[model samples]
Structure formats: C-alpha cells, structure tokens
Target chain A: MTSEHAPIIEMRNIEKHFGSVIALAGVSVDVFPGECHCLLGDNGAGKSTFIKTMSGVHKPTAGEIMFEGKPMHFADPRDAISAGIATVHQHLAMIPLMSVSRNFFMGNEPVKKVGPLKLFDHDYANNVTMEEMRKMGINLRGPDQAVGTLSGGERQTVAIARAVHFGAKVLILDEPTSALGVRQTANVLATIDKVRKQGIAVVFITHNVRHALAVGDRFTVLNRGKTLGTAQRGQITPEELQDMMAGGQEMVALEGSLGGTV
Target chain B: MTDTAQTPEQDERVKEISSFRKALIRPELGGICGTVIVFLFFAIFAGNSGMFNSQGVLNWSTVSAQFMIIAVGACLLMIAGEFDLSVGSMIGFAGMMIAIFSVSLGWPVWLAIILAFLICMSIGALNGYIVIKTGLPSFIVTLAFLFILRGFTIFIPQQLENRTIIGGIADAAEGDWLAPLFGGQVGGWFFEFLGERGLIEVFERGTRAGEPVVDGIPMLIIWALVLVAFGHFLLTRTQFGNWIFAAGGDAEAARNSGVPVNAVKIKMFIMTAFCATVFATCQVMEFGSAAADRGILKEFEAIIAVVIGGALLTGGYGSVIGAALGALIFGVVQQGLFFTGVESSLFRVFLGVILLLAVILNTYIRRLITGER
Candidate 1:
C-alpha cells in the first residue's frame, strides 16, 4: 500500500564511532508510515551501524534522531522499545526453550488474580500472541510450543510478530531474510507486507537488492559509512542503483577489474 | 520443491522430544521412588523384634518431621542453586534459646516459643544478609555459622553451669503444653486424607489385634505439612513462585524479566536458616533437653532428604512434596537397616550408592529428553 504520508522517523547527520573505527559517519535516513524503507549496503557499508542508531543500541556521536519530528536520544534498548521502535536482530532475541507465549510476554507480561496466590495469565498470553501471529499472516501452531522447534524463518516471523503486537510504530528488521531460502524469504517478505498494511513505518534493513526492490517503498544506499543516495521507488533502475552502491564510476571500473566479486 | 528444508516427520519428532523433556525435569520422581523402596524394606524386615509399634511410629515420624520441615526450606534454597551447611548449628542455637527462656528464666512456654522463633528467623535473616553482601557462596557462610553457633550454645551453657545458674533447663520438658505437639501420638495430628485423618499407629501385636491408636499425634508432622503445602504453593502458583523457578532456571533471564533475583536469593538463604531454627525448637521441645552436643551433622540429613527428594543440585527445579518423600525414604532406611541386621556403616554406604544411582538416572533421563542445545 502506497501513501502520501508524512515521515515518521527522520535521522539527521547520524555519526557514530567505536574508539577509532568509524562505524557510521554522518548517515541520514527517513522512514515513512505504511512504508517498507529498505536500508541497503554491503558488509562494511554501515547498514548495521545505521540500524543500531535507530534501535538505541548505539548512541550517535554527533547527530540527532527525530521521532515524529521531535528530537530524541535513546538511553537503552528498553527505552527504544517504549518509543515505538524495535529491532529484530540476526540472533532473534528469544529464549529458545521458553514457550512462544512466555517469550512473547517476556519483559512485559500481563498479571492476573490476587496477590500471594496470583497466577500467570498464560491463556491470555497465548491468545494474544497467536492473534498477533495470525495478523502477521503467519499460521502458527499452539503458542505452547517451544520456539526452538520452529524453523529459522518461522522464528524470525514470530520475532517480527512480537514487535508488531507490542505496539512498535517503527519496525526495524536487521537482515531478516539473509539466511533463509526462497520460500521462507517469501513468507518473511509477506509478513513484512502485513506490517506495512497496519500503517506502521517499517525500516527493512538489508543487503539483498532484489528483496529490497520486491517490497520496499523507498531505498537508501550506504557505502563505507556514508550515504551514497536515497531514492523513491522507480526513480532509479536496479543497474544504476547497483553502480551507486558500488561507489559510482571509479568503483564500477574497479568492480569490473575485480570480476564483479561483490 | 526439489529440496525441502524440513520434513513433517522430523517436526513431529522434535515436538515429541520437547513434550517428553518437560516431564523428565519435574524434580519429584526420584524422591517418591526412594520413599517407596525404603518403606517396603522396613515394613518387610522390622516385623517382630523392634519397636515398630504405634508409639514407635509416632516417634520415628516425629523425628522425620524435623528433617521434613527443614528439607522443605532447603529444597527452596537448592532450587535457587545454593546450600547451607550451618543448619545443624542453627537448630542448636534456637533450641538452646528456647530452653534458656522456658526453664532458666522461668518464662511461660508460649512466650519462650515466640521469642525463640523470632530469634531463629533473625539468625536466618542475618546469615542470608551476610552471604548476599559479601557475595560469598552459602556453603561457606553456613559452614562458618554452624561451628560458631555450636560453640556459642555449649560455651554459654557451661558458663551458666559454672555460675550455679538456677533452673538451668531442668523443667523445659516437664509440662505437657507444647511438648505433646512435637512428641506425636499423644494429642498429635498427621494429615487428613480422603475421609479419615492419618496418624501414627502404635502397639505390640502380641497384645493388640491392630495398631494401637495413640494420644496426641506428632505436632512435627502438622508443622511439616504446613511447610510442604506452603512450599508447593510458592513454587507452582504465585508470581514469586514463578520468579523462584525463573531464578533457579536462569538467573540472568530472570533478572532481565525484573524478578528481583538478588533479593529473592537472599530471602531464600535466610528461609533455610529459619527452617533450621524451627526444627531445633521441635527437637528440644520433644526431648526436654538443649545441650550443645545435639543437632550435630543434622545439615547432612536435610541435604540428603533434598537430594533424595529429586531436586537438582544445580538449582531451579524441585518440589517440596519430593523433599517430604525424601525424608520418609531416609526414615525408612534408618529404621529398616536395623531390622535387616545391616551394620550402620554398611547402611551409609548403601545410601551413598542409591544416591549415586538416583542422580545418574535423573541426569540420563534429562539428557534423553532435552537433547542439549
């Protein structure tokens, strides 16, 4: 779904450094509501660095982040979560042995009954987690199942589902489909589309250009800790976009001599 | 379609493994089995010669009750992954205090009991507080307390004796007020089951057709039941119960979930000491004696009961029911070996073997189900 909407999250001149190594240097990006804004880059192009800035895992050295146009600094990941921003990292932050319902309500669980004889609202937790999963276009088994038994793609889907159910306004996925096969990738991308339909702003951070092109509303390219270009859908062809991502003309020739190893 | 990543059969297999794994880690099965084996052995062997009458039953059960009560508390500590070796000394200290107040000071039984309970709870609180503040393992904290407390109880009593202190613990057991409760079979209560209440059956079959119904059931059994039920409720039902499980299961995860891990652990350490205090109170109340030499190595018995009860030494998994059963198993073994003409030294060796075997079984079953990360 495409919308003529105002931007939800806008990062201006974000700069981050780890001692001497510049992970993210003066990178700026925007995420709009009801849009899957793909943040694409190669291994060292600062894709991870940029997402960490949005996620509150890394505070920018110099720049500022604006959520709904109000500048904010996140103190921790918990603060990031409460600020309608959540990241589903590569490790899929979950206790593998814990039940799906328990993991869904890990940090924030609903309490039930009287004190000294109180009980965990397991039924409500299961129902809510299941409902969220269904809304994400994923048909899962009972929430009692251990998440460790689920497929890698399914696990990632559940993580995304969790972020959405917990009222995340800006969903930041860090390479969600990189290790999955084609069908699983399709399933994940479909799940992403489901999130976009809810009118939440989704930052689909990835390196796979085709995956980005498939579901992204806007594409931003980062290279060597600097923003190469930011383009709306259909503004630049995939080939032109690839050339920019490779660092313009000089790098194009260098890539040609390197036999397109990238 | 040509290369499917997952097979449906494999998925089912994983599900089965997880379901089975949940059962294997319950932490009660070991204790129950041990109880049954020990009970049958005693019943079969302790036939005609020994004091296996109704009064005898009450006496043994009352003795087991102290272990039961303490083991229930120790079970909680073990589930949180810690141990206290000073429980024996704690018991001595508390009992001595009770004797001092009830006999030496000529105070009433109820007042003395209340004061003693408070003193014991305070000792427990102190032990727990010290361990948490120092970040020392409970083994060291409790072990140090044990000998220090033992010396305190004995040295104080000897000094009082030297000073010719009046009424120095002579009348502590003279009255029938509180002693009858811990004594069992003479105004004692065990547990209500189905419709009938279960109490100790005491008699010599030579004169009596059935087991003699004794007066005043063991108050220790009543107290032990309260401890067991309370433990079961705390471990399985309440949010703190859930926190307890989580803390023992994985402390980091529990902390991340805002479980108040440090506070819960400190409380657990104190609770163990508190239970030791209660057990010691019952001991002196039953016997009318509170010497320093008593309660030695009682910590080992509590630990043994917990182990036999099927609690994992690693923490985060056990049941109070299992611990009670574990106590029963110990009681049966202690009495049964005498009937079978087994030497006491040999009996201990047998216990060690059973302990080793049971733990092995527990670990093997655990591996079979969880299948490792």
Candidate 2:
C-alpha cells in the first residue's frame, strides 16, 4: 500500500569496482517510506558492496542516487549521516566499555550551558536514553550501565534506538541477526517491525531467509554482484527465496554432478 | 526476551547491582584504596620521624606535585589510546631550550618560555601526525621521538655552550613578568602568622630565626591541583572528554559514529606536551639551570603512575583523580622510606610490586565490567 508513495531513497544502475574486481555490477534498490526492504544474499553475493555504496562508504563507479526526489552526492559517511542515512554495521559501531547513554549519543551529545561553560547534560541524556530504551522494549538497569554488559540483542536494539532517536530516515542494518540466537533474532525482528511502523524506511541486509521474511515487506535478492530479483511479501515463498540465495540453478547443477558421482 | 515490555521497576531483567559491586567497578577504586593503605603505613611507621610535620609535609607534597603534573598529561593521552614516550625528553629539551634562549642567546625570559612551549607542542603535534598518517602504533612512534628529543637536548646545549648543562637561567629569569607564575610561592604572611602562634616550626638558630621553616606553598603544587581539577572537569563534563573516551575505546566505532578521532588524538598529544613544558619550566626555575639528563626515566614514572591509577594498558577507561592519587602514593612512599631509616633503593622494588598489583586489580575490574572470566 505504501508503494503508492514515491520512494524516499532511489539508486539507479549503481556500479562499483575495486581494482579489476566488479564488486557491484549495475545493482539498484529503492526503499519506500515505512517499509522494511530486505536485501538477501549469500556470503559473497555483493550485498555488502551494494549497501556500502548506498550509505556513502564507497562511491559508485557509475550511478546516481536520488534522495527524496533530489540528486544527491555524499562526500563521506558523515555527509550521508547528516542527510539522515544511518548504518548500523555488523559490529554495531558501538563502544562496549562506554555507558549506554554515552554510546547512545556518541557524536551528537546534548549539552547545557552553565555560565560560560558548556557541559554534557547528564540528566537530559539519562532521561532520554532510558525513555528510548523503554520504548524499544529493552529496560536497562541504568543509563550508566556499560553496553558490554547487555545481551547481543539488546546491543542491536541500542544501535537501532540510537539511529531512530537521531532522526534517521533510512536505517541500514547489515546482517543484524547473523550472530544472534533464536530468541534474540525474534526480538530484533520484532524491533524491526516496530521501527517500520514508525514510518522509517529500513534497509535490512542479511543472509537468513527466515529472518528476512519474518519482518520484511519487500525483498530483493543479489547473486554474484547482480540483482536476482525483487519481490513483495506474499508474492514469493520461503523455499524459493532460499533457493535463489543458494544460487538457484547453480545449486541444481551441483546436485546433479554429485548424484552422477554417487 | 519479551519481558522487556514490562515496566522497568517491575522488570526482572533489570537486576539492580549491589552497591558494593557498583563501587568495585569504579576506575578510581584501586587508586583510592592504595592511597589509604600507603598513608596508614606511613603514619604507623614514621609517626615520630616528623614526616607529617609542616616542613616534611611540604617536601613530599612538592615531589608529588611534580609527578602529578606529568601524570595528568599521561592519563589523558593514555585514555585517548596513545602513548607519549617523549614526555620526559620533551621536559629536558624544553628546559634546555629555555636556558639556551634566556641565558645564552640573551632573549627575554618570557619570550624564551613561550618559544619553548611552541616548539615542544609542535613536536607533539608531529608525533600525532606521523602516527595517524602511517597507521603505526603510537608506542613505536613516540619511542622514536624519545631518543630524538633527548638527542637534541644534549646536542643543542653542547653546540651552543660547549657544555651539556646551562646555568644563569634563574638570574636571567629573575624579576621577569611570567617567571613568577611557575616558580613563585604564595601565602607567606599566613605562614608567618602560624609561626608567631607556634602552630608551625620556626627557625631557631639562623639569621632567619623566628620565621616559619615552611613559609608558603610552591607554585608547582598549585599548578598540579589546577591541572588535576581541570582534567577531571574536562573528562567528566565536556563533549570533548566523551570524544576522548570514544576515540580511545574503539577508533573504528568512534569514527563510524562521526567522531573526529584524529583531531581528538592530536589535541591530546599537544596537551601532553603542554604539561611536559610546564614541568620543565618549573624545574628549571627552581634549580636555576638545565641539564640534558634531568628528566631521565620520568616518562616511565608518569606511565606507571597512570597505570597504577587504574587505567587499562589498552586505553579508553581512566580517571585523572586516580592518577593524582597514584602520584601522591609515589611521593609519600619515596619520602617515607627515607624518614623511616629504610633503604631508599627499596623504592624501586616497591614500584615494581605496586605496578603488578595495580595491573591485577585493573584486570579484575575489567572482567567485572565486561562479565568476562
């Protein structure tokens, strides 16, 4: 239903090459407002390269990025971030030893001026951090608790909540559930669902078909630096998506050769 | 997992830590504990030795102020994930620069001090630049500078005056406008009043009879307190302080989060250099000369103080107050040994033992926070 609205972000014919390696060959993806667009791929299927280009970590060798109907060029990730594109990487980009509130506002800290000195507003930061965490449904023991003490799922939630609080319009999550347990994965997927309902476009990249299908409204599969296809929810089945992620016909030929040998 | 949806006050997952455990995780716990133990030991063993008397207290306090100066710099730099092995050398070099300019070259004393600061801080900036550009470890980069600066300290004096020691700096600096800020003492009248009331010891048999033996506080001690207070406030209350922690904690993560890691590191290096120069100026003013080897091994002493203050060798976590306490311990122990009729050389052995114990404590605290075995 949201597809009736124009895409909040659009990429056209994006190509990236790294010294004789074609990491992304004219790959493109469009994320709509209030949609979870899952980018599904196998280990070396160019998903990482594609998202890196989208988030301004890498300049596309050839392509144009349209952000909200205007042609855009990002000089660096900081530029992309200021434009409301936030990437929560596989490592989560969080310092584990810092307090939760500190990590919550790493770059964009809140300060209150006392006389001539500008001080970090601890009361405001703590209140906002706790309130945001509560909204994400993860109750912290305290804002001062180190992020390292939190579970993996809770850390992901912190990353997500930080992005949302900072007013990120496009949240790019790279393999967020790859290292999580079953229960944790469910929590993250639920968090994703909650985030999407807030009208932010989420670019969720992962290899797990089940996790992708759990919350994704639109799915795009990349194989060997090329888009295999894009499908809306209810237009594709789990087995078909899994087969595509496994390189579809390539898996069939490998099995044939194995069968002949047996 | 879904239990997170419950109100935080009623949530079982939000397990409140016991106050004891909470206190144990503080970065200053080890330093505070070490301070208490050392003071108690000194009181028990050196009580009658007058080690706690007015003049005796001033002696150890002045020495502690020296360590406190450099430890403030080292603590901040270490927390920012870099090492400056050239700090001691910078001190020697800076003092030598001031001596050469003021005593030999006939420059005004204030100008010499300002020039020395500029030159040393530039070297600090260069250290940061090379480390950042080459992606080399700061340990190696600063180690190289350690030798380079020390070499200059010796080479410059020898070439200028045919001697590695320069004198007449105090004479040249006498009555200079900026010299008093570093070398002067304060509160003379208060001490005189104390002596008049017999609250403090007074000279008994010299031309200075009836005057308090300990007249006033030295500027070095004041500088140390100011630096510590400034560092504590900066680390705890400012945005730049948070950036320092982030830059040291994880450079990649901090960069990804939009922190200017390189700039923060460079600023920290410059700060380290500034602290070293302050130390050198104060020392040169007090002693009336500069020698090439004056600050030998002071770099390691500063680092040891910072580590003993409960900072991790890996960086990102520390406290300036803790480092100040560590310096206080060093001063008390170094002076206490002499007062107690013990071998002063035993101080080195104590340092070794205490350093090992501090590392053990820091590791334990690290595990406590990280929940690692």
Candidate 3:
C-alpha cells in the first residue's frame, strides 16, 4: 500500500522541546490515504508530544511538516482543523450533559434565517446527526439524548463520526480505546477499519500491540523520544512489537535483575 | 448480525424511556411543580383575602417581575459556568450613580441611566477579564467585587452630599425623555374606561371617585416579561446559546472545539451587570430615591430563585423558563404569607426548604441523565 500511494501527511524529523526537556527528538512518521498508521509507544515515550506537534497543539522546535506535498505550519489546533486535520483526543472533547446533535455541531452550528434572527436549525442538525451516527453503525435513541447516556464505544464513535463528517482528510486518534472495555475496544477498532475504508488517513496512537495490529496497516514504534523503527503490517510480530515497546534490551536487563519473568 | 440485532434489547441506550423519567428530565420540572403547589396552597389558605383580586395580583406580579429580571441574568451566567455575587451591590451602586448624576449633578435622566449602565457593565467585563486571565474561580472574583461595590455605593453618596441616601430624583427626572420608560404606567386609559363602565372597583368616598383600583400595569412587570422572553429565545434558539451550554458543561472541551469559552463567559458577565442595572433603574424610578441598603441580600435571592428553577450550581443544564417560574413562585409565596395572616419571617424558612428540595431534585435528574445510581 505504501509503495503505490503517496503520503498525505509527512512529518519530517519533527522535534519539540519544552524549555529544558526534549519531548520529541527528530521523530518522523508518514500517513498515506486509506491506511491506518499505528504509533505504538509505552507511557512517557513521546507519543503525546509527537501527536500534539502533528496536530498543531504545539509548534515543532525543529523539522518540517508537509501536507499534500506542500510545507505547512499550523499556528494552532484551529489552523490544523481548517486544513482538514482533525485530532480526536484522549479526553474526546465532548460535553456530556448536552444533546448528541448539539455536541455534533458544537462550534460549527447550522443556522436558519427567521425574519431578522439567525436561529440554530434543530431539524437539520438532528437529521444530520442521526444519519451520520447511523452510518457509523450506532443507532441512537434520539438526537436529543445526552451524550453521557451513551456507552464509551458509542461516544468514541460519535467523536470519530463527527471528525469524518467535517472533512477530515487525516484523522489523528489519540489513545481512543485506553478507557474502554474489551467489547468497546473491538467496536472502536471496527469503527477505525470503517474510517480507513472511506479513504481517510488515520494515525491511531496506542500502547497495546494487539489493538494496534487489529486495524493498523503500518506500525511505527517510539521509545524515549526517538523512533525505534517502522514496519509493514506483515513484517512485525506481536511479541516483537511488544518487546520493542518495552525498550527491548532494557526489558531483558530488568528481567535478569529480578531473576523472574515479568 | 446477531450482535447488531440484539443491541436494541441488550443496550439501555435504545430502551424505551419511561414517561415518568422523561418528565423528570425537563429543566422546568421543579419550578413548575413548586409554582403549582404554591399557587394551590395560597388559593386554599388565602381564598377570601383578595390575594387573587386584580390589585393583589398586581402586587405579587410586580414583586415576581423584580426577581425575574435578576434571575434571568443569573440563569444565563450559571449556564455559562460562572457566578456574579456582586449583582446586589451592582444594583445599589447603579441606582446611586443614577441618582448622583441626575439629582445632584443636574444631568438628564436618560444620560444618567445610560452612564450607570456603562459603568456597571464595564465593571462586569472587568470581573470576567480577571477571572479568565487569572484562571480564578468567578465566585471569588465576584465576591471581592461585591464588597468593593457595596462600599463605594455608600461612600460615594456620603462624600458628595454628607449622606448615604439621596432624594429628589423624581423631581429632577419629571420631564426627562427616558424617565417615562422606567417609571411610567401602561394601558391606563383602558383601565380608566373599565372603571367608567363599572367593570372594576372605583374610589368611592374620597376626593376622587370612580377610579379603578388597578390603574395600569407597571413598566417593571413589562420589563420582566420582555427580558424573560428575550432570554429564553437567546438560550434555546441562538448559536450563542449552544456555546453557553458547552462552555459550562465542559469549558476545556468547548475550547478545543473552538467555542471561545472565555468570550461567552465574559459576555454573560456583562449580561448579569446589565440586568442588575435595569433592576436598579426601575427601583429608583418607582421609589423616587436611592439608598445604599436598597438591594442588600438580593444577590442570594436571585441565586435561590435560579437554583429552584432547576439550574445546577456547577453550571450548564438550565432553562430561562424554569428561572421565570422560580421567580413567580418567590413572588407568590412572599405575598401569599401576608395574605394568609402567617408570619412574614416564615418566608425565609420556605426558601430554605424549597432550595433543599430543588437541589435534591436536580441531583436526581443529573444522575438520570448520566445513568448513574
């Protein structure tokens, strides 16, 4: 797939530093259209910093980002969003007390002109929300139902469906399944597969190698703010990927010191 | 396929919601129930006390209108996840400013009113700015302003005229263009004609006879109704209303989604100040004077009315209609106790009880929404 398709987003040697701490040291990843690119790393291995830089939450201290073959700089998250790069964060960016339709159109509400006043078009918003959620394979009770009432997977689906509907050419999902149950995680993986089939580039960030392999086309491993390697789906085994995630040689040394299997 | 077919049955999301549960989810549920219960109690206890008469109705409605004005502002601000404890002080300060400008400085009544609004709203904006910039809770910031503004309300007039209370505003504003809007009556001719037709009671043994007991509706009630309508429309229909809910429900999430949470909160703060000024303007016009103690404890009253109207203390999840109903309940109960020959001080007891019930109801509703036990 990588051989035949051009990368939609190319992060070339991206590095981000916070005063004295180096969060990302020249890390690079490429996302091609219609493919799931998994970024696997243990906790504190620069996964968050790398994605934040890629999604424009932080400016890269060094290195360039090429979007559709053109060098681009995102001033903020909004800039990246307008350029069709949407990031579904770990926190999900949803108002739980609000209705599904309202959350769907939180910032970009559709309005209809009634005399001199511009009113939120509830009918349009409701129909669109229902239809979009239906297409995502989650049948909502009603558009007016609160987001908090939905299961974790359904909420994650709502967030993903929202990003895809809003013209996200490249979707960056950050630890979406971290808080989900086993069934919920499978649902999320299925949703990811559906999203990839729609020809949108997906950057799926996770620490679980099994979850990554379930839907990912390519795997990129990061350790201690540096990339260990990138491999095609068939080239990397689960145990090999898990070993790399645990800092390979470092895990071996820890096991020897403990004199027991971990 | 089996899983998909079984989802509607196994999952609670698609299950049929009970009608009782549905009714409990309404933001106005508590307020409507309280209003109905209060009205019924008053009707039975004060049946022949003329509490439902035209004059008595006017009295309670006017009082309710005052609460509605401030509660509308508080409702919107609470929905946007902030509090303005300085509302009571703002009312007193605004009235003092208007009196000082119009009565003492010989300024036109209209200009004085506008200037007071400007000053109060600027202070409101400053409150919001400090909260947003400093990342401080609005409760602390507005609490500080509450004392500061109250102190100034007393200090300013005392320094200017060697007294805290100022009079002569009615005489100064007699012919001013804007005085009529704040201190005027409407539909007087209709009431007078009704009195002439023997449809209503008239002044019988006085110097003037055949005058209706209720002449016309006061502008205060009119202002309350208009503000309620406008606030309801803004909360339910506009895009800004959605932003208000999002800002309150999850500000960080709203910000990430580009809702401009700070701007919404600041604008809501200005709105509260605007409401407080309106309240003050109407009070001064009606009383014909301004006093430092005019609006003491009014801020708490407004908050209580809003809370009883089903607005959560933590912000988000409220309605303007609910707030109006809560205000209506306050008006009826405060006036009803006097009509029923009960101790007027018992009104505070009613407020405390009702507030507790409303909070409990709101918590239950929140649990239902969040699907928590």
Candidate 4:
C-alpha cells in the first residue's frame, strides 16, 4: 500500500500512565484498509496499554487520534464504537451463558414492532448473526447455542463477526488466539485474514511471532513505553523481529554493564 | 456434542432449549421440591384436620400473598442489581397514612387509599433517585429508608393522640369504607374483620360438589397471579426486561452496550415501592383498619422469597416465576408449620434453614449452569 491510501485510524504521540508508572509514551501507529497491522511486544512492553488507549478503555494522557483523517477524542468505549472502532479483547467480552445470537448482537440488539408494541425480534438477530458467522466460514450449531459451549477459536470468530456486523472500520484485537491451542490459533488467524478481506483495517496485538508473521502486513513493536519501530513485510524477518522484541541488543548492553560492575 | 446428527431445524430447537434438563436442578426447582416435602409432612402429621382444611388453605394463601406481592417488585429490583430494605416500613407508613387520613382527618376511604398508594410510589421513586444520582450502594439507601419509615411510624402515632385506627381499621372486621371498596360482602360470609369497605367482589366461581364457595378464592391470590403473570411476560418478552438483565449482568458492559442503567434502576426501585403499596392496600382494606404495626418484617420476607425463587444476592440472574414459587414455598412453610405443631416463634429458625439451603442450591445451580459450558 502507498501513502495514497488514507489510513482508517492513526494515533500520534500517545501517552498514558498509572500513578507514577508510565504505561505508554509517544506510541504512534496507523491501520490501513484491508491490511493487518500487528502491534508486537513481550510482557509488560506496553502492548496492552496501546490497545486500551486505542479502544478508549483508557484515554491517552496526551495524543491525537485520527479516524478517517478526522481529529477526535473518544469519551468512552461506546464513543469509540460509534465512531466505527471496535475491539475483541483477550478476555472475550461476551456472556458465555447467553445464546450466540445474544452475544453477537449484544450491544446492538435488533427489535421489531408488533401493532405498535416493541418486541425483541429473536428471529432477525438469530438469522443475521448466524449468516454473518457463516459468511466467515465459521460453522457451528444454531445461533441459540450458548457461547460458553464454543471453543476458544470459535468464540473469537463470533467476536470478530460481531465487530464486523456493527460496522467497525478499525478492528482492534487483543491477543485473540493467546489462549487457544495450536490448531485453534490457526483458526483464529484465518479469522483475522477473513476480517481484513472485508476491507476493515485491523490492529492485531499479539506476542506470538509466528502468528504475526503469518498474518501481518505492517508490524509495530512496543518496548517499555515507546515504539521500537514500524516496518513493512519486506523490512523485517521473523527472527530479527523476535530478537528486537525480546530486547536482544538491549539485554546485551544491560548484561555488559552489570558484568563491568561485578 | 449430541449423538444424533441434528438437522438445522432440530439443532435450532435444541439450541433454544439446551438448558431444559438443567432446570431440574435449578434453585427454584429445589424450592418446589421443598414445598412438596413440607406439604407431605403436614398431610401426614395432621391429615385433613390441618393439610386439606378450607381455612388452612385460606390462611396460608393470605400470609403468602404479602410476600408474593412484595417479592415480585423485589425481583425486578434484584434483576436490576439492587435491593430495597424499606418495604416493611413502607407498608407500615402506607397503612398509617390511610388510618390518619380516613379516621382523624375525616377523609373518605377511597381518597385515603389513593393517597396512600401515591405516597408509597413517591417514596419508592425517591429511593431510586437517590441511588442513581449518588451511585451509592442501594443496600445502604434502602436500609436508611427502612429506618426512616420505622422512626416515623413510632413517633407519629403518639403525636396523633393514638387515633391511628379510624372507622374500624384497628379492630379487624369493623365496617371501614375500605372493605367494600376492595371487594363486596358475599352472602353472610364476608371478611368482616376488615369491616365492610363496601361489599366489592373480585372473584367468583360456581359451586363445586354443591359447595357455594363464596367468592371462592382470596382477592390477594388473584392479584398475585395477575402480577406474577404480568411480570413474567415482561421479563421474557419485553425489551425493558432485556435491559434489566443486561444491566445486572454487568453494569459497565451494559452501559457500553447502550443501556440506560441509571434510569432503569430508578424505575425498578419505584416498582418495588408500588408493590409494597399494593400489599398495604390489600391488608388494610381486608381488615377495614390501617395502622403503624400493620407492616413488620415483611420486607425481609420479600427479599427471602426473591432469593429462594432462584435470584442471586450478588445480582443478575433469576425469574419472576421463580419469585412467585418462592413465595409459595414460604407460604407452605409458615402455614404447614402450624399443622406440624411447630411453635410460631421458631418460624425464624425454619426461615433461616430455607435461606441457607436456597443459597447453597443457588450456588451449585449457577456453577452447574455456567461450568457446563
């Protein structure tokens, strides 16, 4: 993709903190349409912090977020959603006991009128959610199945389908496959691919290097409150990416300094 | 995971009711079982002399009606993830308001009942307002209301020259205008203790086996059934009920999902108050008297009914039908104990057992339901 393609969502100079601990600092990333932008980091490397900032679960201490090239500040998660931003958290923000239809259209439930009486139209919600899931090649039981009965990968697929159904332009996924087994992780990655093909920009946050390499078009690494860098597919290899994210050079310097002191 | 290859249609049906078998172990189901146990004990211990007696059934129904009415609204509040401790005192206050107005001020009974209902509803609304505006724990707010209502009941009677009983409300079966206003007398057989408010009749049935069944059933039972049915329909069929469940399930999630949690909560609080008002009306009108002591510990009974009905104290899961059955279970215990020759004073111990048992059963059911997935 060239600079000619306007990014769907762009964050500039984002900063966040919790008391005296700086969670993120001056992190910048852009998500282009039909592209997978992976935000990579090790534990405590500000990846979760970045996702929260983007999802409006937490406001940046200082930064500008541009959606469709328009400046805005989201007051809360709902605001972000209305602006066509949605998230599939690692924890899977869905009621497991509720039916798949309920979980999929939870925030945006469908309703119909019967002789001026407003009623919950289960049929519509069911068909639409099930159809959307089916379109994504996610086969399962009927829409009325309890979400809790689904596999981790299937639930993630439902979450992605939900975000897409809600008209999300910039989808942010926080380690969607982190809890899945090997084959399940592959299934979720396939979902990420399907999501991108729908022309929605995706911010894929993950610690798994192989998974990211398989799906990511642009990669941004976060290390201790700052952006290490953003690179195109050709700009970095999977091994080099792993080394940088793991603090390969930084660890060497720290070890040298400690050794000199001893 | 079923052994059968489910067609889409069959799968749809199964998905819709995959939890059908699980209901057998639900908390309310256990309460239903307990009701059977208590009834069997009564039948065996006292036989027709106690278990199948006409007066016995009427006695239990009357007592349980209070909890059923109050618990219906409490169930709504609980579904919205809140509580109301002031219902008992609200009952007293409502009764007193009618007594003071109809007796001392010489106001008509009809006006007094209307005024009493309105006042109760207003207080309920006020409680809701305070809860939402401050975002405080509803437990404390309702407890405070309980104390406030109790205080007024105690202090106001003495100031009014002990004339809290007017036109036959104090002494049961006095001809207070309230009696006929609720339901008229039936051929030599009227609940005269509340007095003839005006001989109004709400239910009637043909003689069964040549028994004239005067008005046949308690007006309170009919009302409870109506309200319970209405409440059940609302929870299962309406958007508002959906909102209540969502709100209780997770307030933050609901808010993000576009539910008006604060406004809905306030509305639920008021609904509870309105229910309390209805119970007070029935009790006062039936006995043709209204006074401060009319409502006592009834609020706790309502909450207990809710919990026993399968509602979680921690909020966000239960049914209105469950609450109604819970009240029935409670009714059985209270009335059945009389047949079992248990001391009325030990009712608290019996209730404690039910409470503990309901909690244990509820936890297990919840685990079973959620963990199965």
Q: Which regions in candidate 2 have their CA more than 4 angstroms from the true location?
A: A253-262, B1-15
For model 4, state the Cα shift of residue B192 in Å: 17
lDDT of candidate 2 over B143-255, digit per residue (tens)? 99999999999998899899999999889987899988888899999999999999999999889989999989999999999999999999989988999999999988888
Question: Interface RMSD for candidate number 3?
Answer: 3.6
Ranking by TM-score: 2, 3, 4, 1
- Candidate 1 residues A1-262, lDDT tens each? 3456668899999999999999888998888888989988878899887887888778899888999889988986677888889788765455454557766776566668875456777778889988876665545556766565566787788888888888989998889999988988887887888789998999998877788888898889999999987899989777676776776778677768888655
lDDT of each: 0.73, 0.90, 0.90, 0.77
DockQ per model, Cα: 0.16, 0.51, 0.52, 0.24
Q: Between which residue pairs do clashes occur in model 3?
A: none
Task: Give candidate 4 misplaced runs (Cα > 4 Å).
Answer: A2-4, A12-28, A40-64, A71-76, A127-145, A178-183, A207-211, A222-229, A237-262, B1-28, B50-55, B98-137, B159-213, B216-219, B339-342, B345-363
What would the per-residue lDDT of candidate 2 be over residues A34-58, giving only the tens digit for each residue?
A: 9999999999999988888888889
DockQ order of candidates, top first: 3, 2, 4, 1
- Per residue, candidate 3 scores C-alpha lDDT tens digits across B1-373 of 1122123423453678888877667878888788888999999999899899888899999999999999999999999999999999999999999999998898999999999999999999999999999999999999999999999999999999989999999998888899878888899999899889987777897776778999999999999999999999999899999999999998988877778899999999999999999999999999999999988988988988998898878887888999999899998999999999899899889877877887788667776775544
Of 1 and 4, the candidate ranking higher by TM-score: 4
Tens digits of per-residue lDDT for model 1, B1-373:
1223232422434433355546655556666566666666677767664547665676567667777888988899888767878888888778877777777777877677778878777777787788778978778988898888888888776776542122334355556465555543433233222113334444436664244356556667888888888888777555566566556766665553445667788778778877887787667766667777677888888888888777767776667888888787676666667656778777788788767766666555444322324
On residues A1-262, what C-alpha lDDT tens digit does candidate 4 reach at each position? 7477998888999999899999997899888999999999999999988887888778999898898999888887888898888888776466665567876777676777888777777888888977887776665556756676777877788888888889989999989878988777877888788789889999999988888988899999988889989999988987677767877776556647777331
Error of 4 at A254 (Å): 8.5
Please report how far candidate 1 places residue B316 from its true position, in Å. 2.8
Q: lDDT of candidate 3 vs native?
A: 0.90
